[model samples]
Structures are given as C-alpha cells and as structure tokens.
Target chain A: MKIPTLHIPDGFISAPVSLLFLVISGFFVFLALRGAKKQLDEKVAPLAGLAAVFIFAMQMINFPVAAGTSGHLIGGALAAILIGPWAGVLAVTVVLIVQALVFADGGLTAIGLNVFIMSVLATLGAWYLFRFFQKIFPKNRIGFLTATAIASYLSVPISALGFTFQFALGGTAAITLDKVLIAMVGVHSVIGIGEAIITVLTISAVLSVRKDLVFGASKLKVSLVR
Target chain B: MSTKRIVQIGLVLSLFVAAFVSFYASANPDGLEFVAEQVGFLDTAKDSATGSSPLADYGLTGFEDERLSVGIAGIIGVLLTAVISFGLFTLIKKR
Candidate 1:
C-alpha cells in the first residue's frame, strides 16, 4: 500500500491558482504575525511554541477512520484553544512550512493552497465557532470543552469545503466539483469526529493541569472572576 | 505544576509522540487523499519539488528499517518545529 500524503501534493492544482493562494497566504501570515504580537507575551510565548511542536508531532499519527482511510490532527481548534487564534494561525503555519520545506510532507508548490485551507481557514473557522458556542453555553469547563469539540468537528468539513472550492477553480483533473465536494465532505465528516475527540481530549488534559495557560478556558476564568 | 514544568512536560510528551508512538500510526490514505482517489483526481498528483530530499515522505535516507527512518524523521520534525516556532514567537513577543 502507498503511504498517504498529509496535505495537497504538487500538480494537483494549476500554477496560477496555486500562486494566488500563496499570495493570499502571505497576507494572512503577515496578519497573524501582527495579531500574535499582543498575545505572545513572555508567559505565553513558550507555550505557543510548544503548541506548534505538539501539533507537528500529533499530526504524524494518523488514526484510521474507516476502510482505507485515516485521519490525523489538523490542530487548528486545538491550537486556537491552547494559544489564541492569531498565534494558532502562526503556529500551524509554521508547522506547515516546516513540513513542506524540510520533510516534504506537503507540496512545495502547493504550500499556498495548503496553508490557506488548513491554517487560515481552519484556524479562523474554529476560533469563531468556538466563540459562538461559548456565547450560547454556560461559561464553564464543560461548556468550553463542548465548544472546542463542536468547533473542531465543524472545522474539518469547512476545510474540506475550502479544498473543494480550490479544486473547482484550478483542479488539474476533470472530476466534477459536485463529486469532489461530496466525497471530500463525506469522508472528512467522519475524520472531523476524530478531530473533535482529539481536540477535546488534549484541551481537557491541559485544562486539568493548568487552566491559566489554556486560552479558551482562561477566558471563562476571566468571566467568572468578573 | 508551574508553567515551566508544564511546558517541560509538554515538550517531553511531544518528543515521546514523535520518536516512539509515530511508528504505530495508521498507514491508510488520509481523508483528502482518499477523497481524491474516490473522486478520480488522484492521478493528477505530481511528485513534490523536494521529492528527492533525504527526509522526503517522513523517512530518512540510508536507513533500512522503516520504523527507525520514520521515527528519526519525526523527531527531527519536532525539534525543527519547536526551534523555529519558538524563535518566531519570541521575536514577535512583547518586551
């Protein structure tokens, strides 16, 4: 059996389209760097770095979701909850860049597309969704975990949809967009469940040990203190 | 535990996951790859530009044992990611 590639490979999307995403990804990275400035004080900087390292390591383990398909940690929701959203974006982007350059895990040419979907889209999607959920539910540990789980679950399908949109624009193959959309979303929905479980577990573990360090939980603490 | 100790524990956990547990990870195609195959676009994937790198596909070159090769690669990845990310975060960090 062939080893599964983690992210988009080269030649899957046209060069022009790929380059467009690269430019867009560059913009987001700039925004992330600037946004992370306020969030990355001395206390949080090391934890943010650790979050990136942990994400890189966890992404290596692909748990089987079904026959012939496996899923790994996207680390968007997990990162956002551990660090802030901006740092989460930077952290995951750093991982993706390292994977593409050193490990060749993701395509060098397709780095833009990969980062746009996995880093930008997933990170923002998870962050906002979690916030939305937090607003609706009680501001407790359970509520935070529930929000993280739900947001993590939804982020995968959102990313899948991002891929489908990219493919529709510059796909090298002749496959219909409808088929790609359905299949990508279908498989990733199950994968998202795994993502949710892992995200919840990791968040809970951190929350148990150090509530102050967790970005999501700390917000709740702030509200409770108020 | 203090923040320092917690960070230390997290680092150890990352190292353990990358260097040891990664070998037992599933070998099946990931969601995107599986979807591409099912939807008939799998053939469009070309070899990565860095396909010939020693660490390509998460395996170090010149190692006969697949486990050792991948394990070493994972450890290297973890270290590189930590160093680079820490540097970036520190650089951008507020004084």
Candidate 2:
C-alpha cells in the first residue's frame, strides 16, 4: 500500500469553499495568537514547543484501526489539555503548515480546511468538553485521564463532521451525502478510540511526573472540606 | 521535575517515536482516505502541489530504503516542528 496522505488533499472540496475556509481559518489563527499571548509566558513557552514536536512525531505513526483502515493521533485534544485551547490551536496549526509545506501530507489549497477542522474545531471542542467533564469527575489522576479520554474521543468524530460539512458544501465528487456521513462518522468513531487512548496515555504520563505542566490539571479545584 | 528535564525527556521520546517506532506504522489508508474511497469520492482527490518534494508523503525521495527514508523524514519533521513552534511560542511570550 502507498504511504497514506494523512489529511485532505486538493480537489476533494471546491475552490470557492477552500478559499472561504482559508479566510475563516486565518481569522481563527489571529484570534489564537492574541489569546495565546496571555498564556504563553516564559515558563510555558518551552513546554509548548515540546508539545508541538510530540504531536508532529505522533502523527507519523498510523496504527491500523480496522480492516483496510488506519488512524493516527490528531493531537489537538492532547495539546489543548496539556497547554490550553489557544496555544493548542497555534501548535496544531504549526504542525499542519509544516506538514503541508514540507511533507505534503496535506494539500496546499486544502491547508485552511485542515486547519479549521483539526486546529480550531478539534482543539477548542475538546477543551470545552474536557472542562465540562472535569466538573463531573474527581480532581485526581484517574479523573483527569477519564475526562481526557472522553473529550479526545469525541473530538475526532467532531473533526469528521467538520469534513462532512465542507464536503456537503463543495465536494468535487458526487457521492451521496448520507453515505459520506455514515462512512466518515463510522470510520472516525473507531479512529477516535485510538485518539482517546493516546491522549489519555500521554496525559497520564505527564501527570505522573509533572502534573503542574498540564493546563487542565492546574484548573482542578480542591475542596476545603475534603 | 524541572522544566528543562521535562523538555529533555519529551524531546527524547518524540525523537524515538518519529525516528524508530514510526517505521512500523500501518500502511493502510487512514480514516479520511478510507471514507473517501468507500464513498466513491477517492477519485476526486488530486495531487498536492508539493507532491514531488523530497520529503513528500513522509519519505525521502531518491532513497531506496523505505525505512531510512521515512525515518529520516520523520526526524526532520520533528526538528522542524520543534523549531517553528518554539520560535512562535517565544514570540508570543515576548509580546
């Protein structure tokens, strides 16, 4: 089998839709930069760099999820939980840009589409979901991993939905919408499990040694009565 | 652990994964590409503009050994990602 191009390539979506997403993605990157400025102080800066490198490295490994299908960590959820949503977006954006420009893993024209889904949609969505779950779970290691697993799992399907939405708007092919939805969501659901496992494992690893580095863990409030 | 230690460990782990462990990754089409194929839209996919890059598809062009090609490319990607992201975060920290 040929080495899989891990991201959306050109011609999957129409030119107009791609350009539209370019503008949208660009705007989000700008917002991320502004927001990241507040969180990316001197101490957190190197951690952010390590997080991006780890993400890029992990994306290289595609584990087989099912027959004829493989999956890799998106790492958006992992980054968001490790750092924060804003900086997470920038990290993933950097990965996407590098992959596109250097490795050609993603298409040039489709860079915006990839960024919107992986960087904006997955990172922010996972962060918010994690925050919600954090309220329900205990403020401990198990609780943190549970929340990370749940949020990261859902984040993958959410990203799949992003692609489905774009394809519906401007797919170059004439595939049926329902089929596209079913196949995309079905495969991604399995892929999401891989994402969840990796995210949880990585989070737990860091939490074991340096829990202070995890942005999500830092937000956990300890009860005075407990 | 000190911040420097954490970065050091993380870097080592990342390099190991990208350079060695990644060589064993599954070669099957990923979820997105699988969906496109099963849904009859795979043909709509076109070559990326950088399809001919030396590092396109995560393998070094002109290298006969697939393992070495991919391994080297993975290392390059990790380093590039580290530099760009670190520079970006430093700039953000300053601003």
Candidate 3:
C-alpha cells in the first residue's frame, strides 16, 4: 500500500502562489533567526535541536486517527512550549526541509507553502494561544499541560485552514472552496485530537523531571505539584 | 537532570522512535491526503521532483527489507535533522 503523507506535492498549487509563499516563508525564517538569538540561551539551544530531532522522529509514526485516515505530530505547539516561538518555528521548518529534500515527502516548490502553514502559522499561532490559555488556567502543572493540549489541538485545524486559504488563492484544481474547507477542517479536527495527546504527554514528561527547561514554565509562578 | 542530559536522552529516544518504531506506523493516508482525495483534488497532485532520490519515500535504495529500508532512512533523517538544526541554533543563539 502506498503510504500517504500530509506534505503537499507539486501541481496542486500554481507556481505564482508557491513562489509567493516561498518569499513569505523566507521572511519568517529571517525573523525567527533574529528572535531566536534573543530567546535561545546556552541551555535552550540544544533543546531546540532536540526539538527538531524529536519532531522529525515523531512525524514518522502516523497513528490511525479516523477510518482510513492517519495523522502524525506537527510538533508546533510542543516546540513552542519547550523552546520559544522563534526556535519552534525553525525546528519545524528544518524538519519540513529535510522531509522535502531528502525524503521527497513534500514538493520541492511547495516548501514555502508547507513552511508557512506548519512552521510559521502553526508555531506562532500556537505560542500566542498557549500564553493566553496559561493565563486563564489554574497556573499549575495541570493547567500548563491543559493549555498545551488545547493550543496544540487547535494548531492542527488552524494550519489546515491555512492550507485551505492557500488553496483558495492558488489551487490549480477546479474544486469548490467550501468543499475543501469543510473536508480539510473536518478530518483535521479529528487528527487534532491525536496531536493534543502526543503534545500534552511530551510536555508533561519534560515537566516531570525538568520543569525549568520548559520555556512556558517560566511564566507559571505557581509551585509545581511534584 | 542537567540540560545536556535531557537533550542526550531526548536524542536517543528520537533515534529509537525513528529507526525502529516507525516501521509499524499505519500505512493509511494522512488527514490532508484523505481530505484531498475526498474533496476530489487529489488527482491534481504531482510527483515530487526528487522522487528518484535514494532515500525517497523513506525507503533506502536497493534495499528490499521493508523494516531496514525505513529504519535506515529514519536514522539518516534523524541525524541530518540533528546536525542541521543543532548547528543552526548554535549559530543563532544569543551571544
């Protein structure tokens, strides 16, 4: 059986749209570098690398989420919570690049699209949502993990909407935009559950032994329930 | 645990997952692919330009064993990701 992945292949989107995203993605990458410089200290730098490695590894395991549909970790929220938003973007971007160039999982020309949706939008968007949720939650370990899970869950469908928007703009196929939106969002909502489970579990595991390493933990002033 | 120890252990777990556990991943289409197929635009997708690369599709070239093929590809992917990301982060970290 031919295994299907979420990495967008070529020909589905127009060249102009693809190039547009490429430039957009490049700009975000540049900003990430600048932001990472300030955010990544000596300790966080290695964790950033491990974040990329872990994301790459987890992406390979596509658990069955729905009938005939499997989903793997996007790791955007996990990255942002563990590392900072900027490094999180870079981590996921590096994984997408490797998957495209080496594994040929995604289209070469569509790197920008993939990066924009998964790397930029997912990571940055999740970071903000995480901060917001962390404030409103109980401010304990459970609240932290709960915030992570919610943000991570929403990130999947949010990124899926990003794809839909791009498809509306430059999709080559003669399909209705509404159909794409509903289907993309529907399946992704289910997949988002899987994303939430993996992300919360990973973050919880890290928090267990090394809460200090978690970037998001810095804001939660409450004592951890060790 | 120290940050170095955490990172070291994380890397080992990553390697283990990619190289061994990945072999058992479900073969069904992912959410996006399934949605695309269901929405009727899946036919518009084109093959990747680097489809002929030795490690294309996460399988090693000239390797027939399914387990070893994906496992080796996964290992290579993990290492490559580690090198590139680690180096990049090291360079960009605050001075």
Q: Report, for every candidate in turn, its global Cα lDDT versus the true structure.
A: 0.88, 0.90, 0.91
Q: Tell me each candidate's RMSD, in Å, in order.
A: 1.8, 1.8, 1.1
Q: Individual DockQ of the candidates?
A: 0.79, 0.81, 0.83
Across residues A65-95, which tens digit of lDDT does each residue of candidate 1 receive?
8878999989998998789899999999999
Show where candidate 3 strays beyond 4 Å: A1-3, A220-222
Worst 10 residues of 1 chain B by lDDT: B1-10
Model 2 lDDT, full chain set: 0.90
TM-score of 3: 0.98
lDDT tens digits by residue: candidate 2, A113-183: 99999999999999999999988988666776788999999999999999999999999998788899988
> For model 1, what is the error of residue B11's alpha carbon versus the real structure, in angstroms, after optimal superposition?
1.1
Give the poorly placed runs of model 1, Cα more than 4 Å off.
Answer: A1-3, A220-226
Q: Is 2 or 3 the stronger prediction by TM-score?
A: 3
Candidate 2 - chain A - TM = 0.96
> Distance from true position, residue B16, model 1, in Å?
0.9
Off by over 4 Å in 2: A222-226
Q: How close is candidate 1 to the true structure, as a TM-score?
A: 0.97
lDDT of 2 by residue, B1-95 (tens): 89899999999999999998888999999999999888899898899999889999999888888889888998999999999999889889744
List the lowest-lDDT window of 10 residues for candidate 2 chain A.
Answer: A217-226
Candidate numbers, best lDDT first, in rank order: 3, 2, 1
